[model samples]
Target: MPTPIKLSSRNDYESFLEKFDTFLLDCDGVLWHGNTLLPGVREVLALLRQKGKRLIFVTNNSAKSRASYSLKFKKLNIEVNENEIFCSAYIAAYYLKNILKFPKEKKIYVIGESGITEELDLEGIRSCGSSEDDDGKDFDFNDIHPDPTVGAVLCGLDTRINYKKIAKAFNYLYSNPDCLFLLTNDDSTIPYNGTLYPGTGSLVAPLIKSLNRNPDAVMGKPNKPMMDCITNEFQLDVERTCMIGDRLNTDIQFGINGKLKTLLVLTGISKEHDILIKNAPIVPDYYLPSLGDFSELCK
Candidate 1:
């Protein structure tokens, strides 16, 4: 087996960053906490740009589309184009179209937020609800029947989900085990304005719990699909790409799994002492107090 790679000092991390050409960044915690941008984050981004390093924002949140994120980035004073942002929504669409090889016009049953439906549309996949009748009008429950052509069951963040929808999705999944069970991302909760709101993972977890079925696939950070998409879309060299984030589980694990350098900034979710815990599976290639510290390291 190959020896595990580790970095224990700031010097070691700076040396690694000096050689890297591409930077894969995590958005939520690393760049901003909810709507609040972390201190000195802008400077770090500017410095990276000045040094001619390619930067790509990789996020696991699929509740919103790329266009939504692009607008959010602009509001946050981050200059990111559409191509620079990659979310789980994009990966989910890619997997459904390419990996599963679903037919161009196949109908899908989606139990997700609006973003999930939008992503399916982008791939030219048709989504039908259980209530649709022959004429495409909403049908009563007595007349509702599972559409045999349903290609897959896609679960995302559905704030308006009810028992009826959940039951329908569960029945479809149980009857069609061969059909794909795709999740946008596995985020348990999202931090917003200092409060925790249920994320897609919370919504999907119940279905998994009720059916006792693991997802056939989850296309997000710490997964191979997102990493592959980054490489293919940006033409970045994996060995030279560094992942910088504020979380240990997702961000650090993504770098470790992808064999790229990982930097953990303490300005967000995970703290410095957390890594010192006895059984922590996550350890970053570098540890900084915040993105501000990274600015100094580059100089």
Candidate 2:
């Protein structure tokens, strides 16, 4: 087992600066909590950009479109482009259209926001069952009419998750053996606006239990689809690329799964001591109090 290396001293930080050329970062916890930007995150990003580092923002949140996410960055006075941002929604769409070769005529039953539908639309993919109609309705469990046109069922964070959606998704997966069932990200919990809430996993749990079938794919951190998307798009040297995130299971494990070095930050979900405990789920290569601590190297 590889123990985490704490970069405490100036020499340690400087040595790390020479080591990595690219960075993969998580957006919610590692960069900011909800909409508020963490202290020195801007500086750290600016410094890394100035130092010619390739920075990629990888997030599992399937709520916001890349354009909207970029607007949030612009609102915070951070320089960003749509290309640098990678979200689960985009990858889910990509995986379905490209990897799975899902037919264009077939529609997806989506239990998510427009962030997902927008990406699917970009690929000429159609979707139905958004919160507008599918969510919050009562399910009688008897005359459940599953949409035969729905060739796939995709789940993400639906704030209004209810019986109707579950019944439909469950029936689609249970009845249609050829129907693809996927999740943008199965994060059991998520941090948003400085609070924890049940994530996509929780919303999809009922359907999973009722259908008794696992999703064909989970397009998020700690998974191969996300790694495949990035590695295929960019030429990243596995040893030189580092993934920095706040969560242990999703983010740190994501790096480990990709065979890239990892860095855990304490500013979000995981505590400093969480990684030090024996038999940790996934230990990072290096850690600091926060990503902003890397600003020290800018000097």
Candidate 3:
């Protein structure tokens, strides 16, 4: 358990910036709060780009696809390439298509948003449910009809998650032992616009409790599978990379577990005192009041 150094001054930023050739940034807390961009974020990002740092916007939010995330960058007036974004939805699709070698004849039953289907489509894989099941239909045991073609049940952050989707997903995994159960991210809560809301883990809690099983794979932060996907695709030198985020458990732990440097920001869930809690499970290598502190380096 290493103590985290606070980064504040310009020299601190300069020294910190020199250590990492690549930066993996978490979206929700460090960069923005919902649709609003944080202070000095755009400037610091520009500076990082100017210095030729490889910036990859890694997010556990699976409600949006890569394309959708790119659009969000555009909306924020942030100049980011679509290739620079890696959302859990994209990771899930990559894992299914490349790692699992998901069969062509089989389709995935999605318990998320359109992002899951969008990414799956990009991989030439078929997915059912999601928006199709967003009619708020009530779940009925008599309506249960498992589709043999459905080989997996993929769950993510679904704002429209209902009993119908959970019941249907439950039946698929329950009836077919071969049906793979996957979660884009088991995040219990998400930070948005200065508040926390139920995340993917909350939505998937019902199925997990009912079936007495966890996902075969959780494709997000603090998980090795997602880290493996990024490393294999980018061919990054872990020593020259750093993961920056607001949370201790997911973002910082992801970096630590992946053997990369970790930086904690205070714009989101975990405050500075969290690292001092008794028996804290994870601690970041460095801490900053806000990533905006790096803006002085650009000046």
Candidate 4:
């Protein structure tokens, strides 16, 4: 039962800052809640920049593309480069394009929002079944004429998920064993504006149940695919990098599994009690009340 050191004092902040040359930060809970900026986040980020620390925003939110996320940063008046963000949507696209080398003649059936499709477009990959397919039309077994050209089914956080989309996606996988199944992420719940809502994992439950199969790859936090992509892209030295987030399952576990330093912040899905529980399955190397704690150092 190893206890996590609480980062509170200025000395603690100094030591922590000096320990890592790169910081991988989770967006929703650690930096902001929905559109609202968390307390002292800007100051802390500025301080890190001043110290010449490399910052990377890593998020499992597949509902937005990197360009869309960049807009959110601008809305908050935060100066962030598009390259500094690595999102699940982008990872999925990258996987299809570079790793998977998806056939040019084939198309992807997207069970998600524009985020997934937008990234796919950037990769010069064709896709369908996103916002355009989310019409209020009821599902009809007869309407499902499975497209053999649909080489893959990519699932993400689809707020507009309906029976039609699910039925179509299921049919694609069922009819074509070769049709690859991919998930942008599997976060069960997402923190938004201080409330927990069903995430991408929840959306894919029906598909998983009906298909009786897991995705071939889940390109998000705590997954090796996403981590490998990041490592290759940045050439990161895992030992000198720290992962900071508010969730134990995805964020902290991502860091721990990758052999990187993990820092848990008590501002999102995971609370202090989670780590304090007896025989906790996962724990971070350090815990802090918030990323904003560095505000004092910034002062």
Task: Give the alpha-carbon lDDT of every model.
Answer: 0.76, 0.87, 0.91, 0.92
State every prediction's TM-score relative to the real structure.
Answer: 0.86, 0.95, 0.97, 0.98
Residue-level lDDT of model 1, residues 85-190, one tens digit each, is: 8888877887778777788656777776666677778988788652331233343466545655776887776666666667677777777776667787777877
Ranking by lDDT: 4, 3, 2, 1
Model 3 root mean square deviation, Cα atoms: 1.2
Pitting candidate 1 against candidate 2, the one with the higher TM-score is 2
lDDT, residue 98, candidate 4 = 87
lDDT of 4 by residue, 1-299 (tens): 58888888999999999999999999999999878798999999989998999999999999899999999999998889998999999999999998999999999999888888999999999999998777887667898887999999999998898888988999999999999999999999877766788999988999889989998999999998788888878978888999999989999999998999999999889999999889988989999999999999977
Off by over 4 Å in 1: 1-16, 129-144, 296-299
Q: What is the model-wide C-alpha lDDT for candidate 4?
A: 0.92
Query: Per-residue error at 206 for model 2, in Å?
Result: 0.6
Off by over 4 Å in 2: 134-143
User: Every model's Cα RMSD, please?
Assistant: 4.2, 1.6, 1.2, 1.0
Clashing residue pairs found in predicted model 3 = none
Pairs in steric clash, model 2:
none
Write down the TM-score for model 2.
Answer: 0.95
Instruction: Give lDDT: candidate 2, residue 195.
Output: 77
Q: Choose the strongest candidate by lDDT.
A: 4
Q: Quick one: best TM-score, which candidate?
A: 4
